[model samples]
Target: MKKILKQVTKYEKRISVLLMVLSLALIFNFCINSASAASGDIIYVNGSSGNDSWDGLSAAWTSGTNGPKLSIKNATGTVNSGGTVRIADGNYNGINNTKININKNMAIIGQSQTGTVINGTDSAWIFKIQPGATVTIENLTITNGNAYNGGAIYNAGNLTVSEGRFTDNHAYVAGSAIYNHGTLAVVYSSFLNNDADGGYGDPAYNFAAGAIYNDGNLTVTDSYFSENCAMYGHGAAIHNNGVLIVTGTDFIGNSVYGLGGAIYNDNALLMANSNFIANVAYAAGGAIYNIGTLAVTGSNFMGNVAYGAFYAPYISTAGGAIYNDYGGTYTVDSCQFAGNIPQDIYNNTEASSGYGSGVITGSSDVQGATVKAANKTMPLQKTGMPLIGFISAVLLVLGGSAVSKRR
Candidate 1:
C-alpha cells in the first residue's frame, strides 16, 4: 500500500507541472496574437481629409487614448494617410509588402537612414510616393529601393525632403534618388552616391539624372550632392526639363555617359553662390552640357574637363569642358571655368553631332539683369514646407532616440 501511494503522488506532481507550462504557453500565444492584430491596422501616406493627426494628443487612433503601436517586423502592412508608424528600429530586410500609400497626411519616423532601414525589396522602391499626395519624410535613412525610375523615391506630386541621406540608391531610367514629375524642393538635404544609370528599360533612353530628373519645377538650396552618376545624356547632377534654381549648394564627383558631367539643362538653369567640381563626362561638357541657356552668378566651375571629339589631347581645350548644343547660351559672372580640356571652344560643327556653345573663358555676363532664367519658383505645398528642415528633424529622432509623439 505504501508503494502504490508513492506512485500516485509522483504522477500528481508531474501533472501539476504540465498544467502550469500549458497555462504559460497559452498566455504567450495570446499576447503574440494581439500584437500582430494591432500592426495590421491601415493608415494614410500624406493626403488629408481636412483632419490633422500630428497635433492633438491621442493614444488609440480610434478612441483617442493610447495611439496604436506600429510593429512590422518582417510582416506585411499598408500605410495610407491616417496615423504615424514607428519603425521600432531594426532591419526590415525582407519583401514585406510594406507601403505608404498616399491617402491622408502621414508621417514615418524611422531611426536615421543608416540605422533604421526600410528595405522594400522583392519589388520596387522602398517608399513609393503616389501622385496627388503631399508626403513629409524625416529622420529616415531609406535605400535599396530598386526601380527602373526613382530608385529610392518616385514622386508624382509635391514632395518635401529634409535631413535624409539617399545613398547607393539607383534607378534605370531617371532620377536615381528622386524621379520627380510634378514639383520638388530640397533644402538642407544631402544626396550622395545615387546613380542614374539607364539600361534596357521602357523607352530605353538616357534618363539617369544623378540626384533628380525634374521635368517640372525644382528648387535646391543649401544642399549637397556628391559622387552621383548618370548613364547617358544631360546634366549628370540635374536633367531639368523645366526650371531649376540652385542657391548655396555643392555638386561634386558627378559623371555622365554623354554630356554634362555636372549639369545637363534643357530648359533653363540658374545658380547663385554655388560650387561644381570634379565632374566628368564621356562626351562634351565635362562640367556642363547646356542644351538650353545656362546662367550663373557668384558660382564656380573649375577642375572640369572638356575632352574634345578629336583623339589628340589638348590640355588648354575649352569648349569640351562646357558644351552648349543646339544654340545653347550662357550668361555667367564671378564664375570660374578653368582646368578644362576641350577639343574646341565653340561651334565645332565638324566634331560629329555635338556642337558646344559656351566656354569657360568667354560669353555673356548678364544678358541683361532680369532674364528668363530657369524659373526658381518651387512647387507650392503646405505642411512641412522647406523639405530640408523636416529631414534634419527626422534624422535627429532616428539616430537611436526613442520616438514618443502624443498625436
Candidate 2:
C-alpha cells in the first residue's frame, strides 16, 4: 500500500510540472501575438502588386486578404498617429493629382533614395503637411512636381527631411521644391535643377526662391543645392523671410534674374562652414543679399558673378560675394571671398546713400580666399531588422528553453 501511494504521488508531481509548462507556453504565445499586433502600427505601401481592399498589415501578400496598401495616400489615411509608413521601390505617380495632406505626426520612409520616387508628373503638389502636425521624410526622390507654390512639399507645421533628393520641380510663384511656414530642418539632402518662374503674367510680379522659401524658422545641415534658377525673381537657392541657420551646406551654379543668386535674407541669417561657388546674380549680391541682420563664419565664396542689368533704377550691380543693404547689420568672421567678379563686398549705405548706417564688422580674407575641394559623396545607412523577425527569434529561444527543462 505504501509503494502504491508513492508511485501515485510521483505521477501527480509530473502532471503538475506538465501543466505549469503548458501555462508558460500559453503565456509566451499570447505575448508574442501582442507584440505582433503592436508591430502592425507600421504600415506598408507598395505601388506595384498591392491591393487597396486588403488590410495593410503585412509587408507582402498573405493568404486571406492581408497585404500592403496600393498607394501612399491610402496608407497615410489608415495609419495611426505616430506610426510609420514604409514605401517600396517604385514610381508613385498619378496616384493622386491633389496633394497628399498629412495632419498627423508620422514618418514616411522609403526603401532607397533613388529607387523610390514620388513623381508628380508636373501635375500638382506632392505633399502638404497641415498645421499642428509633425512629420519626417527620409530616403526618397521627389521630382516633376508643379504647383503655384511649393511644387514638391508645403509645410505649415514641423517637418524634417533627411537623405532626400528634390529635383526637376517647378513652381509658378515661389519655392520650387519646398515652402515652409513652420519650423523646418533639412539634413543630408540635395536640391537640384529646380526652377521658379513667374508664370504667364507681368514680369513685375514677385516670384522668388527656386529651391526653398521660408517664412518661419529653418535649419539646413550638410545639404547641397545646385543649378537652381529663379526667373524674374530673387534668391535662386533660398528666400528667407524668417530666421535661417545654414551649416556645412553648399550652393553651386545657382542663378537669379533679379537679386541674390544663392540667398536673399529679409530677416536674421547665420551661415557657418558653407560654400558658394559660381552663383550668378543679375542685379546685386552674387552669393548673398541681406536686408536685415547677417552673420557668416568660416565660409567661402568663389567665382560668383553679378554682371547683368540692374532690375531697379536705384539698385547697383555690385557685391559679387555679398551685398549689405542700407540699415542692415552684418558681421563676417574667418570668411574667405575670392575670385568674385567686380568686387567682394558692397555696403549699400556707404556706396549710395552715404548713410554709413549699416554696421559692418569682423575680418575677412578678400584678396585670396582659401580654396577647398568639396566631397559630395554621401551614402545611406542601413536600418535594423524587422519587428517580426525579432519576435520570431525570441519565441524560438523561449521554446528551446521550455523543451530543455521538460527533458
Candidate 3:
C-alpha cells in the first residue's frame, strides 16, 4: 500500500510538470503574436509595383498575398491607429474622387524629399486631415494640386511637416498649398511657386494666402518661401488670422496685387531671425501688412518694393517693409530695414514704436519721420555681444593669444 501511494504521488508530480511546460509554451506563443502584431502595424506603399489586394506588411513583394500596397489610400486604410505608412520613391497620383481622408493619428514618411512625389495632377486636394486627428508628414514633395480652397493639403487637425516641398499648387480662394484650421508646425520645408489666383472670368476677384492660410496656431522654423503669388489678394505667402510664430525663415520673391507681399497678419504674429528679400506689393506692405499685433526681432528686410497703382480713383503705396495699419499694435526690436522701395516702415497706428538698434530707411513714414543712422549694423540682441567681440573671443580660445584691433 505504501509503494502504490508513492507511485501515485510520483505520477501526480509528473502531470504537474507537464502542465507547467504547456502553460509556459502558450504564454510564449502569445507574446510572440503580440509582438508581431505591433511590428505589423506599419504599412508600406509602393506606387510603382504594388498590389492593393495584398497585405501591406512588407516593403518588397514576398508572395502573392503579402506585399506593399499600391496607393497611399490603401496603406492608410490598412494601417492601425497611430501606425506609420511608409511610402516608396515614386510619384503617386490619381487620388480618389474625393480627397484622401485621414481620420486617425499616424505618420506618413517618404523615402526621400525629392524622390517621393505626390502629384495631384491639378485634380483636387491631395490629403485632408480630418478633425481630431494628428498627422506627421516627412520627406515628401506635394505638388501640382488645384483646388478652390486648399490646393495641396487641407489640415483640420494637428499636423507636423518636416523636410517637405510644396510647389506649383494653385487655389482659387485661399491657401494654395495648405489651409490650416488647427495646430500646425512646419520645419525645414519650402514653399515655391504656389499661387492663390482668381478663377477664370474673375480677374477682379480677391483671393487670400498664396502658400498657407492659418486660422489656428502655426509655428514655422527654418523654412523657405519663394515665388508665391496672390494675384488679387492679401498675403502673397501667408495669411494669418490666428497666432503665427516664424523663426529662422526666409521669404523671397513673393508678390501680391493687394497687401502684404509676404505675410498678412490679422491676429497675432511674431517673427525672429527671418529675412524678407525682393517681395513686391502693388498696394501696400511689400513684406508684411499688420492689422493686428506684430512683434519683429532680429530680422532683416531688404529690396522689398511697394509700388502704387492708379486703380481708377486713388493711388495707394505704402510700407515697403511693413505697413502697420490704423489701430494695429506693433513693436520692432533690433530689426534692420534697408533698400526698400517707397518706404521701409509705414506706421498709421496711434502708438506703434520701435526699440533697440532697429534702423529704418530714409523714406519711412513712421510718426512723420524716418530713423536713419550712418553706421548702422546688423540686428543684434540687446544681451548679445558684437560680432567683432565674438570673433575675438573665438580667436583667443583657439590660439590662446590676444588679438590686436585694426581700426
Alpha-carbon deviation at 386 in model 2, angstroms: 37
lDDT of 3 by residue, 145-231 (tens): 888888999998878888999999988888999989877788899999898874422645455788998897788888988878887
In the range 13-120, model 2's lDDT, one tens digit per residue, is 434533443454355334323321122378888888887777888889988789998888888888998888899999998864237999988888999999999998
For residue 359, model 2's alpha carbon misses the true position, in angstroms, by 6.1
Residue 280, candidate 2: C-alpha displacement in angstroms: 0.5
TM, every model: 0.63, 0.77, 0.77
How high is the lDDT of residue 265 in model 1?
81
Candidate 2's displacement at residue 303, Å, is 0.2
TM-score of 1: 0.63
lDDT of 2 at 105: 80
Output the TM-score of candidate 3. Answer: 0.77
Q: Per-residue lDDT for 1-407 in model 1, tens only? A: 99888656644543443344345335533432332111223332211111133222222344543233333321113343434444444555444423444544445555465666656552457666666555556666666666777777777766666667677776777887787775566777788777766663234575668778888667777887776777654567778877677778877666666567777788767767776555666666766766665666566554555544332332234244455555565544445444444432233333465543332222222111222233232221122235464343234323422211001
Error of 1 at 388 (Å): 26
Cα RMSD of predicted structure 1: 27.1
Which ranges of candidate 3 are over 4 A from the true structure? 1-40, 96-98, 198-207, 310-317, 349-376, 379-407
Candidate 1 vs candidate 2: which has greater TM-score? 2
Clashes of each: 33, 0, 0
